[model samples]
Target chain A: MIEVHEIVKKYGENNIVLNIEQLYIPKGQCFGLVGNNGAGKTTLFSLLLDLIQPTTGRIVSNNIQVNLSEEWKPFTSAYIDESFLIGYLTPEEYFYFIGELRGWKQNEVDEFIGGFQDFFNGEILGRKKYIRDLSKGNAKKTGIIAALIGNPQIIILDEPFANLDPTTQFRLKFILRKLLENKETTVLISSHDLQHIVEVSERIVVLDRGCIVKDIQKSEETMQELESFFKDKISLT
Target chain B: MIRLLQFEWKAFLRSASYNTHLFIKIILALAALYLVILFFSLGFGLYFILEEQGMKPFDVVNRVLIYYICIDLVIRYFLQKMPVMNIRPFMIVNLKKNTVINFAITKTLFSFFNLVHIFFLIPFSIVLINKGFNLSGVFSWCICILVLIYINNYLNLLANNQDVFLYGLISVVCIGGLSEYFGLLDISRYTSPIFYNMYTGKGSLIVLFLIIVGLHYVVFRFYKKNFFLDGGLSIRTRSVHAGDYSWLNRFGTTGIFLKNDIKLLSRNKRSRSTLLISVLFTLYGLLFFSDGLEVYENPTLHIFAGIFVSGGFLFTFGQFVPSWDSAYYPLLMSQNIQYRDYLNSKWWLIVIATGISTVISSFYIFFGWDAYVAVLTGAIYNIGINAHLVLMGGAFIKTPIDLSKNKNIFGDKQAFNIKTLLLSLPKLVLPIVLFAIGQNIFNSTTGYLMVAGTGILGFTLKQRVFKQIEKIYQKEKYKTLKAYKAQNNF
Candidate 1:
């Protein structure tokens, strides 16, 4: 479970990137965060990850204060972008590295990665080039796969579908669905693609301009509501 | 062409760390020019110095000519980058590949390095002319030397671009140096006559000319093949090997960081070059050990020698510290790794590196048993005291290194803080002073024991020192991460 209490993230003077009063997501919940650019989705994740200190209040992940203790790090895995990747390493090397960090045996890592053959589509596995040399989409796959390595209880992915091909995107949905089958698992995903988020998440939260604009449970007409809300708001801006 | 050159000049000057401080860049440029002038004067006086040192007048210039060329080739091999045609935009446009290739080769032709030989050969030739040598023989020899300089330039490019040529260059240089050192063949004496023959032998001058032309043709062809397709679109042969440093696992969390740091140092170009420079430094004996035994008698000299001898590579490499990982520092900071384990892994890595370097440098014992003792004590203090001092100093560093680049290695822009300079200073000076006082008060054995004793004290205090370093690192973590992310000029 993760909780944000009266959290305020500031950038210099008069610039508040995030100002969330209270947020709580219990374990096994697939929490979807939808936002446009500069919607403070990343800022909130960064705060929860303890990458930046909050201007006010605190974030507690699994009842452990994020800033004060590192208990959340063992269970949390995030791949926000290429910065998460050691670009000099090959995808396979990077995967094994991640597995090693999480204390998985090499054999177990190889077997787990083998399961993604269909997902990989032969573009990423056993590739000769380093992650830096790979195409953007392939590089994204590398990072995403690295994040999913080991038995991380909480998964955080930012813009997962951005650089993925249509097939991979379709495959990623099934992956998320399978991951969510474990009731004790917590997944926090942020995306501009409301459709995929709506399909995968049990609850969806919309963020706009450092404020949570909408928090609604996913239902039959969730996609339609999200569309109308974004259309009306984004057009006005 | 002028416009293109102007645009390139602007791009080069504007984008480079030239923007950091104009005063710094100006000082750097002057320093570079000063080095060239100093080396040129050395070349200019080399023959006379050899004569003074009691070599025959004629054989003096001839003996050193080959060594000078070899040193020049070696320096250029490590330093010069191939002039790449920035042709990505032009590739999709109405440009011929040959035009771009020709422009690139021409750009290389005009580099300061191409004219550096003038600094060496021209002055020597002027002196030869002034020393009542025959004009035609002197002219013919000058022509031969100038032709070889051109050959060195073109062949240097050949070595740069082709893997076979590059490896061949490295092997030739390494094997040649080793062979000369072991007295397998006197390379200087064997090659000396070739230049000496150029004075009277029209045959030798003709041969040198042919070789220069042949090398130019070969180098041109190699460049053509590389830039031939799509105007050098960078179609490189990529290969990846799986590295398993899993044996490093028993240390728990520290093992994980050690594995990553090893991969980081081995896999990346910048880091690999750092390792190579460190390895090359194992030859510090050839420089320092060349001194007389009298220098070894000074207790302080032993400490200085130990600093360089034992920790030659690590001392230089460790100062950069966590900044070398500035590329993925945020990822590291986000991971489950403790600051203690992170710094410890770096410490152990430097210790291991210093151990290996010390072993290789153990050959210094050939100088004397005293040299050997100094090296051992130095290694102890270096690994124990110096490593911690550097780690503690590194805690204050916020200048993130661009590990993704091998663009400008010699720009040597280390942000050495007062804390770093002051702390690491005692690693060298303190050992010397301690050894001196101990020797004066008691005897030489006590002094050696005191140096080792100081190292033991530092080693025992490591945990306490590490705690303070950990606090500093955590306190400055955000500022360090911010600085790292700001290095975006890939």
Candidate 2:
């Protein structure tokens, strides 16, 4: 479970990028955060990862206060940006490094990531090339696979499908669906792709400017309703 | 063509203009060069007026050619080699490579140092000719000097293309060895006949010109063929193991910091090079002080100088602590790390480094027990003093350094800021003052023992000094960040 209570973040005087009040993500649910560019999605993710400090209020994850502590960090995995991937290391090396950080043995890491090998079509694991050399889709795959390697209780992904091809995006959706069926892992993904969000996420939150303007659950409404709602909100603005 | 030149000039000036620091640097460079030229020109003018009574016509003509050749070579080498400009970006445009190369080569001709060569050489040559030396003799010497200058420049370019320091050492050794061999064997006497005609004024001027031109062509051809965007050293890509040093688990934060320091030093080329050079320089004292104190009758002065030289490693390595982390400082600050732990890591790193240097210097200590004791005292004093000084200086100093950019050992850009210099003053003065006061108070052995004892005391009190510095760092954290960004013009 993740709770963001009245978080406020500012760059300088009067330049508040995020102003939000009370957002609770229940355990074992897929939450899709949708926003246009510069709608504070990345800022919120950064705060969640403890990459930056919030100006006010607090974030609590799994009963532990969200801080830059090893305990809180181990249970959470996030791919906020490309820089999260250490560009110098190969996919296999990065996976092992992340595993070691989470105190997982080599066999454990191999076993965990080995499951995603079929999905990657034999392109990712054990490739001796650096992440910088990998194509955009393959790099995203590498990041996603590593994040999922530790089997963290909570996972956050920012624009996971941004640079991926259609085929890879479809494969990723399939993987997420499988993850959702487990009912133990909580996933928060922020993306602009409404179609994919509608398909994978159980709960959808639409953010405009720096505020969450709409929240809809899949069980609460049909897919067409949410689509129409998003269209109407965008046109009204 | 003129428009292209204007565009290039605009770009260079604009880049320079962005940073007030770089603009100051350019002005300082120009001023320094101007002063050097003025001094040399004054000396030459005095020599001509008083000794030679002005230059002869032939000497003037010969000197002009020599001057041009030397100036051209130096300018060409600098223009082609300095990676600062990175003219590779121009290659992707509609501009031809030849045109760009031509522009670059032409820019070399405008150097003030090159102009200085012309001023001094031309006047000196004229005076020599006026003093009744034969035209051929004057011309031969001038042409030889010209060729020598080109040879020097080309050699430097070749060395710059390779590792600068490694090739510089090789070149110095080669020149020293060759000079010694020639002096001993009189090999020049045997080869004199080959150049006898040229020296005697019978050889053609066209031949000399052709030779110089051919050398220039060769340099250009070599550079043109091999000089791609990434032609020099192959970039090494290493697999970084996260949490690789589990041994640090014992010391907790200190251990983690030490491990990170080790990883950083190993991964970054500048830090690694600085560490390597520190070791090398510490050992260099051995070569100088090998003979023992009796070699210099006054053991006190010799020991003092030895002590100063022995402390070289710490001073050089400690000076750049803050600059090393400039690039990743934001990430470092954002992490929930204690200020004391960060400073302690640096302190420990210096201790480890100084310890290694002290052990190496122990070899020289074997020559005499007194020398051993003196060096040990100096090393210990430096370690204690520098640990405090570096931490304090790091807190106050706000210079941000990009370790990725290749900098010279004595580059002005990397040299003393007010904070560093001010911090260094006490380190310098304290050692000398301590040594002096000790020498006045007691016998040499007793004084040496006291110095050594005080150094030990300092080492014990280092943690307190470190804590004080850490408090200062915490207090001025934001200011330091601002300073760092300001210094680098980030």
Candidate 3:
């Protein structure tokens, strides 16, 4: 579980990236955050991850203040961008490295990755090239897979479906859904694709500029309503 | 902690020599090890060498302990890198900031630069022990010196954190100057006797140890609060074009390329810091030309210092050539720009830099016009000959330098090595050898003419050299791009 309390991030005199008064992402929920370009989605994620200190408030992950202590690091996994990937290693080397960090055995990691071969599509592991040399999709897959290692209690993926092929995207959804079904893992994913977000996320939050405009539980009409909301924004633009 | 370091060690090794042929790494490692051992041996044999040179080893070293420690601190401050273990993955983990930072600090304590001073002290102490000096006191002195060195390491981190360490550096220089002046004047001979008494005094190391612990505490507090991966990675300001390089617009394709090159150097912290450091190094000529004018009697030393002073900007910037743009190299490669034009743009930047340095160093005319001509010849040769050699050397370098990391002067282990420094050695040394032979054997004018003639001939053959290096670049293009794409170095 993650709590953002009175979080306000400012860049100078007036520019505020996020001003969420309070947010609690419950355990076992596949929470999808949807937003436009300047919707402060990444900013909120940054605050939650404790990459940057919140200007006005605090974030508590799993009952520990994110800034006050690093106790939450053990249960959480996040991959926001390319910086998360160590580009020099072979994909296999990278996987083994993550395994070493989280105290997973080499064989366990191999077995786990072996299960994702279809998702990898024969393009990631066992490849001769370094992860940096992988195609953008493959690189994203490598990062995503690395984050999932250790069977972390909380998983956070930012723009995970972006830079992925359509097939890998579907496979990733399947993987995410399985995680959701576990009912013990807290999954947080942010994406621009409403349909994909709807397909995987049990609870969805919509953000505009730094405020949460909507927070709705999934229903049959949720996808149609989310689509029309964006379509209306487009017409207004 | 060991597990964390183990990962770092693996990254260090696996990341190195990815683009280089295996045989070269072996040879280069052997060569660097050989040189390190050779320096250690020189340290071991310092007493003998000083005796041969008619200097009293104990008298000199004892008297100049302050000078040695002070100068070493300044030099270490400039060149020594802060040991950084990228702690990003550990941040959200159960790992404590204390554990991570202490590992980084401890690792730095064992850095080659820190340990090098011991190489000298150990030998000197052995000589003192052999000479029947108080062994425990000598041992304590050595421990204190080593502690002081570690303190310097922590102090360097603190100073580097503050941006400019000029105050510390200036105070060191002023103290040394006053000490030397008074030490010579016999106006209450101060620093030498104080240091000598401190070293010979009993249990001085306990105090030294206390100072080190206090420093460690300060350094701990500093890194604990400020250590963040985002600070290391994030672009603090958007000034990709903060400076006006628009004057380069007139020079056609190469000019356009040069403008971008200028922007890259001005924008990126790593490259910009190196450029600023190189400019600071222009002051190095003062070290050679100011003192014993007798020092420049050795033509090899004189010309080597001269070239380094006048054309070092080219050397530093050119040696990394294409690697500087490795981050955006793929985009550059995919552009409609011609490879020759891009190469020429780099060449132009080096030439223009060399010219500015040569003119600045022309002030050496006060020392001797021959020295001035030598600086000019060095600049010309760097422009005409070593420029292409550097480009040729760049073509073979596969380690992509992180342009953005303000981490340190040398971004990563692979980005710079003794072998890369030696890449243009023959070109550099050939002029030195020719100038030496011509000056000492023939005449001073022949020395200047010999260097100048070589520059002229090389400038004439510039087209041939460019053609050769271009072929080399073509062969290396694909592999270079592959290596550049990887964040192999953390």
Measured against the true structure, the TM-scores of the candidates, in listed sequence, are 0.88, 0.70, 0.60
Greater-DockQ candidate between 1 and 2:
1
lDDT of 1 by residue, A1-237 (tens): 899899988889899888899999999999999988998998888777887889999999988999998878889998887788887788887787788778887799999999999888999887677888888999898888788888888889988989898999999999989999979789999999888889999999999889998899999989999999988986897
- The per-model lDDT (C-alpha) reads 0.78, 0.65, 0.74
Q: What is the DockQ for all candidates, taken in turn?
A: 0.57, 0.17, 0.02
Which 10-residue window of candidate 3 chain B scores lowest in summed lDDT? B233-242
Give the CAPRI class of candidate 2.
incorrect
For candidate 2, write residues A7-115 as lDDT tens digits: 9988799888888898999999999988888889988887786666688989998887765343466678877655556454567766765676566766898888888
Give the least accurate 10-residue stretch of model 3 chain A, judged by summed lDDT.
A81-90
Residue-level error in angstroms, candidate 2, position A82: 5.6
Please, what are the lDDT tens digits per residue for candidate 3 over residues B410-462? 43446455556678786678888888888887886788678778878888988
Clashing pairs in 3: A73-B92, A73-B93
Q: Cα deviation of A232 in candidate 2 (Å)?
A: 8.6
- Residue B254 of model 3: what lDDT? 71
